[model samples]
Target chain A: MHAQDSSTGSLIAHTESPWRLFWQLLQRDRLAMAGLGILLALAVVALLGKATTEWLVIFDPTTVRLVDKFRAPLSEASALLPDADRPLTGVYLLGTDELGRDVFARMLQGSFVSMSIGFVAVGISIAVGVVLGGIAGYYGEVRIGPVTVDTLIMRFTDAMLCIPIFFLILVVVALLPASIYNIMIVIGLTRWMGISRFVRAEFLSLREQDFVLAARALGLPAYRIIFWHMMPNAMAPVLVTATIGVATAILTESALSFLGFGVQPPFATWGNILADGKNFIFDAPWLFFIPGFAIFVIVLAFNLLGEGMREALNPKLQRR
Target chain B: MSTAALLEVRDLAKHFALRRGLLGRPSGWIKAVDGVSFHVREGETLALVGESGCGKTTTGRAVLRLIEPSSGSVTFDGQELLKLNAGDLQRMRRDIQIVFQDPYSSLNPRMTVGNIVGEALRVHGIARGAELNERVAHILERVGLSPDFRHRYAHEFSGGQRQRVGIARALAMAPRFIVCDEAVSALDVSIQAQVINLLKDLQDEYRLAYLFITHDLNVVRHIAQRVAVMYLGRIVETAGTDELFDNPRHPYTRALLAANPLPDPSSPRPRALRGDVPSPLTPPPGCAFHPRCAEALAHCDRQTPTWIQIARRHGVACHLHQNTSRQGDDEIPDG
Candidate 1:
């Protein structure tokens, strides 16, 4: 009866209605919102770096100069550099790394690496896991195909789940030549199994519903039937899982780099810089403090955001 | 409409393993669908009515091979549907569709109405762009909705509208046979009427065949041309709608009729049927209904009654209905 209003007005669900609900939950979690804000700011810095700096300059983060090495932050001794390599001491306020690289520039470049990997990997994990789960849950009646697939998928997930992911990731990274792309793909591909199981459980419950039967009756094909229709209907719990997964992925990548397995040496990931500053902790505390705080805020932010989304998206919570 | 049988399920059976031995062999089977059979002629509505655990849903799913049966053959038109490959089976799906029970969780919230309906068209390569738009609009209209609904999400719609959208999505595929598996059971009474009426109108326009499975005899009575009453994975009685209701042959069917409390208090109501439905896994050795059948005799306890064809196109599974006089001396306490 409510959608009857579409007769008079627009076809889309009033965009404001759902967003308002999202806003209400998100706003209440001040910490999550703050984390969300910080990550967003970091993203903006990464995206707009070209506009912010005159030279699109060494977006190739790997280029290095050993001679201008380990220049301390804003110190007079390490201040000067010639034209081609010139970054003003005032301009490069965070100072340079061991390669005479501006730490701020490297940080901005590295933000792109860390966040994109975190997001893309999680996205892949969620997509693959959700599809597998949906099929296993929905087609419980079909004995032959799903039985083997479900077993393969679940056992694979079990293998991944039992192994310490950090240790496994290190071993995997070691086997391959260290690259940001490699880390992103490896993390994303391996992490989807748990989400798949969770999604399957949701689908198992949801497939018993009448509308789904109605959709089936209408002869919706398998792809649209499952992915477009059934999956979205059964997606809430998965969304919560995915949100938490993003934070977990970020933390994993950071930990890997810190242990000298991820992002590699001189690449200056948040983990690399934090590890770099550990030696200088007694001398200059700001280096460890800033990046350490960034990691803490982001992890906390994603966790809070995940919580808010869970409460917001969960139909059980909607009733209250 | 052309004269043809829309769908036919011959001796369909699906036995689910209840428990497996250490060697992975099934120790016992829950005979979920046991040699059940029925048909829907073109443009006719056939209802399969049974209490919960009666395999009505299973029968419906098995007919379309949604749940492949342990044994049996199903032919839609002249073609054998069970033999079709996955791709052909997918194409066959555009012909025989199903409507499920709960409206709330069926439609994908992320998909807009247009995509939901248009997907079937895309998969079958029926329409695209402007033609797809027009076809989608046409379908929305056929289901008593405006074309404007094309862009909306399921969450925006009410239970009834979502159900309509569910209907609209089905109709978009232009299917010949549909299994409405308790489609209206979850709706409010008013909404149920709307959906039922909509289904009727769409049936008339499309010349569709329906295998409507429901526990609600009232709905079956209103819509079914023929009705089959199922019990414990077996259909015990089947006849034309009026004949089955007026002269229900099986004790289970009689109990089902007795259990349905009519709204009018003035009408005589029979005594309530007692005892739970017997488990499908470990059913009574003789008659599956004998554990609770008041008319069960010593003979009833020793042998399972075969489906006897009585009246024209009518069948029943009870020894009591074998002759002019009832077999058992005991009478049901109707007071």
Candidate 2:
């Protein structure tokens, strides 16, 4: 009896919780770890930018000096501003743009804008996707005249997909006033189709599960069945989609700003700064290269994180 | 047993329409449950037995209105379930519960056993807080699980334990009738007996009625008071457990019984029915079992046989039993 009790104790001890297993799986992938590290560092940078700009006035992003214009990265600020009444201190870390504003300060401010747009846009898309997808999948069989709820919603999604989204965003953003909120809303509204499809597919399969049927048989309301019972099961794919979606939203915002359709001037977004550096690309490559590299690294980080999450969440791919 | 019927299903049918082309045009109807009729008295077990895709599961689902019946009457305690509005039907579900076949799929993997069992109580506003936890603990203990096990998720348990969680979920509502749809079919042979005995004990303790649907004949013989053998989409024979096993009237019922595996190795294997079950999409015109029935008559292919009562609580829908009926009326027999 004592031996049997010990054996049972060992057996119980061996069963790891699902969350711990997911974390363990994620940790094994070196590329995913690199991605997570990059994203965490960028998040800290974005938060620091917000704090410095709003509360502590650390780096002045908008201050301009005509003498310091077109200074290469790591150039001496004192050398550029010699014999000045207000002599600049330290080195120009990432150099100055054509407008003579500090590149490092602008990049820091841009980090905050890019990160906020990425999150808020993805949040909007996830909300729209889950709602539309939940309705489509759960009530897919319910027919209205010739078309089903599934058919109607999916066809609308297909129609949205058919349009070249960038051009559509270009036209809409051109018509609307240039603001960060407008950019976030437009990118969010257009990019939700893929997430919706993921959610719809998840719901379609999940609704037929016996647990869902059991929930129904237990006299739970339709809302409870959809949100409480089915949504949690459908969330893994949605999380992956939303992670990738943040990257897409960030890229789109950058592209829109580059084309002069995104967040307007006075706000130093990466895209606008890149747009400013376009004419002087050869003379001051760091101005364009710095923001360009930032965008690339952040997007790649999010994509890697999303892929890692996908593999970790999938039970078939999990290692014992 | 009580003479009053707790649940009565009359001429229940569920036809699934096969869609074709991009527009989803109706190509054909698969009559999954065609004119199935049965009842369960208070605390009685009525086993609906059939092979896979024979509509026994569908019948049970339709009776509870889980999957809506195409056309039929399901009267649960004299309340027409089909006619009830959404809210009323939902309210009515508290009394009628179901235990599913696959233990792995029947439970929410994310939920703790306590939440899975206590969700119904919270949803119906029956209990909350400490009372809810106490109830969940009590129900868990009743299903032969430790009260401490309620904190664990469904993935931590074995197949038998998961099934017990399912039963506890159903039993939490204090339901009068439960449709056990292949409840033990997914468990091991050794575990099957334990679940069956647990179900039996629960029925006696709660006076719960069960519409037990399964293809396993041994389980039916062990737990059921009455057995209904289905062929194609319709019930061919239904009788008392002992009467059906001792004297099966229909050719389909006999073939099904003969096909049961024997423990004795030296015993010659009984000749099983020839050919597969006909597809419900396009079943044979007359009796659906004509192609598979060994004693098929020429008229069996051209005309359908009417249901006839051979004795008290014994009925068969076959041409061979057409002439041996004590009650000559073509109407379905009611208890």
TM-scores, one per candidate:
0.83, 0.95
What's the distance in Å from true for residue A274, model 2?
Answer: 1.9
Worst 10 residues of 2 chain B by lDDT: B326-335
Per-chain TM-score of chain B, candidate 1? 0.92
Summarize candidate 2's per-residue lDDT along B229-271 as a digit string, tens digits: 8887898888999999999989988998888887888887898
Look at candidate 1 and tell me the lDDT of residue B228: 83
In order, candidate lDDTs are 0.74, 0.87
Classified by CAPRI criteria, candidate 2 counts as: acceptable
- The digit string of per-residue lDDT tens for model 1 on A78-135 reads 3444445655433445655555566666666666667777888899898788767766
RMSD to the hidden true structure, all candidates = 5.4, 2.7
Which whole-number lDDT from 0 to 100 does residue A9 have in model 2? 36
Off by over 4 Å in 1: A1-30, A47-92, A95-106, A116-147, A172-190, A199-221, A224-226, A230-243, B1-5, B19-24, B325-335
Candidate 2 regions with alpha-carbon error over 4 angstroms: A1-17, A79-89, B20-25
User: Candidate 2: TM-score?
Assistant: 0.95
